[model samples]
Target: MSKLDSLLAIPVLDRSNQPRIQAAVDGKAKPPRALGRIEELAVQLAVIQKKSLPSVRQPQLLVFAGDHGLTRSGVAAFPSGVTVSMVDTLLAGRASANAFARVVGARVSVIDAGVAADLSDRRGLIHAKIAMGTQDASKAPAMSTDQVISGLLAGADIATQAIGDGADLICLGEMGIGNSSSAALVIHRLAPAPLEICVGPGAGHSPEGLAHKHMVLAKAAARTDAAEPLEVLTQFGGYEIAMMAGALLASAKAGVAVVVDGVICSAAALIALRLAPQALDYCIFAHASVEPGHRVIMEALEAKPLLDLDMRVGEGTGTLLAIPLLQAACALLSDVADLKDVLEAAS
Candidate 1:
């Protein structure tokens, strides 16, 4: 079996410890459910790990960078070159994600899933490129079958590496300029919702540009075979997106928490959820993007995101910002004394 198949073949999520984890959280010195969503992240982490007090200790941010051919079709305001430039900006640790990662004590790694530019010379970039970029979905398939497998394996390998290297949790991020358009189309198919609901202004489109994007993406969505995961990938998904889907599966298979970002990542998460429904057991939605499609996809996952800041910067910044919440969740249960323990100690 292929790596992707092998991973998915693993048993569904082992939520056998659900009651114990919830009890542990309630038993903390804090009142029942006092930590709110922090407690929620914690409880879910415990269930995924099959243990109470699961640590968010070695959090790693996996940022998959790519370019979209749809951008050339005037679907977005920023030129595709910005994808390469932003990947470099991210590698320099100056991007907003880096700042947020610094605060959460998480390591950030960028994967070149398929940037149109050659970043081979850039130090510290993961060379997982499937091609220079995908074919323009408006004109042809977004990716080939082989590219699909390659992208999925590349992402699976990254998540496996993070787990092998002791990463307790991994967050998904991306840097493809026109990928918001690609993401919208994926959401349209996977959400199986109305195509118009998924369309959104990418990079602040002008009225004319927004209308053009809608026209292009609506056509793109029509081309998709939404019922099958791989078919929808070829029809609408980008390399970064395909890779993130793989990452979600690998993380879930290994029983690691996957912190998912906004709409683009949500698009990938939607695909991953389709491929492996139990992946949601390992996923924590980081935020709700301003992108309209995000609402539909997030609803599909039945996910309550950690934040709803009107943030749409998509470098996994939302996931990075939400990392501390995971940390706080762990601390709340692990570090805080149990009510009975405190009471007994005071006697």
Candidate 2:
């Protein structure tokens, strides 16, 4: 069976411990439901682990970097060189993802899934290059079928490594000059929203640039009627986006929680969800991005984000911010004692 087929075969999160998990939470000293969304997060952690007390330890953040041929269509304001340069920032521990991961005590790995330029042998970089970059989807499919499979497996392999290294949760992020455009088109096929609502100013595009980006994305999406998640992915997905989707599936199969970042990450999540609906049971939307269309995708998936920092910078920033909340949720489960302890203390 294909790797995706194996992911499809995995059942939804095991929930036999739900009652025990809730009882543990209720036994805490605090009033019921005081933690708000965090209570739900704790419950999900337990369900994924099949245990009443759950903890999110050694979280892994994988940032896949690629180049998009769609950038040649004048979609993004920045040049393609930024993809390679930012990989340097990540390796040097200077990028936003690194800072956030450091704050949350998580490890970060950078993958060169399909960057157009060559990067030096950086210690933290995972060299999973499938091609120099994706083809210009405005003229042809973004990735060939073989390229898609390669990208997907590369992502799954990273998750395997993280699991082997003992990560209890994973977060997905991306770096590509025109990936936001690819993500927009990916959404166009998966969810039926107006073409206008699907476009956004990624990495700071001016009004004219945004309009041009919309036109480019609309034309790119019009290139295909293939609505199957895989087909839509190859038609408009960047290598990083496709790989991130694969990682989501693999992480779920390992019974690990996946903290999904902003709009681009959400687009990848949508693709993975299409492949295996149960995968959603293991995912946590980190935040609602500044990108307007992110809300549309969240609505389609019925996902409520953990934060609303008005963030759209991507690169897993939102996911890192949400980690503390997950940890707090787990603390309530693991650290808080039963009501019997509370009453005994009072006596």
Report clashes for each candidate as comma-separated counts: 0, 0
RMSD of each: 1.5, 1.3
Model 1 / residue 27 / CA error / Å:
1.6
> What is the per-residue lDDT of model 1 for residues 261-342, given as tens digits with 9 covering 90 to 100?
9899999989988988877878899998998989999787778888999988888999988887887887876898899998
What lDDT, from 0 to 1, does candidate 2 have?
0.87
TM-score of each: 0.96, 0.97
Clash tally for model 1: 0
For candidate 1, give the lDDT: 0.87
Candidate 2 segments exceeding 4 Å error:
none
